[model samples]
Target: MKRVIARCLIMVVTLLLISGCNTIRGAGEDIERGGEAIQRSAGG
Candidate 1:
């Protein structure tokens, strides 16, 4: 029973980490696009 519970906990943590990574990556892309827009507007 203990082993089953441990496995489930690990799986949940792993999923959460993976989701967090994707969220960070998406945010980075959004910020990069915003920066590019600013640069274009500034004629730089």
Candidate 2:
């Protein structure tokens, strides 16, 4: 019973970390795209 609980806790933490990483990457991409749009408008 103790082993099962430990395994579940580890799995939940791992999943949370993975999700956080994805969110950060997505935010970075959005910022980069916004900068490019600004430059394009200024140049044209």
With a 3 Å backbone cut-off (N, CA, C), the pairs that clash in candidate 2 are none
Q: Candidate 2, residues 1-44: lDDT per residue as tens digits?
A: 99999999999999986775588778688778889999999995
lDDT string for model 1 (1-44, tens) is 99999999999999986775588778688779889999999999
Name the runs in model 2 displaced over 4 angstroms. 23-44
Which lDDT value does model 1 have at 4? 100
How far in Å is the alpha carbon of 16 misplaced in model 2?
0.3
- How far out, in Å, is residue 30 in model 1? 15
In each prediction, how many residue pairs overlap at the backbone (N, C-alpha, C within less than 3 A)? 0, 0
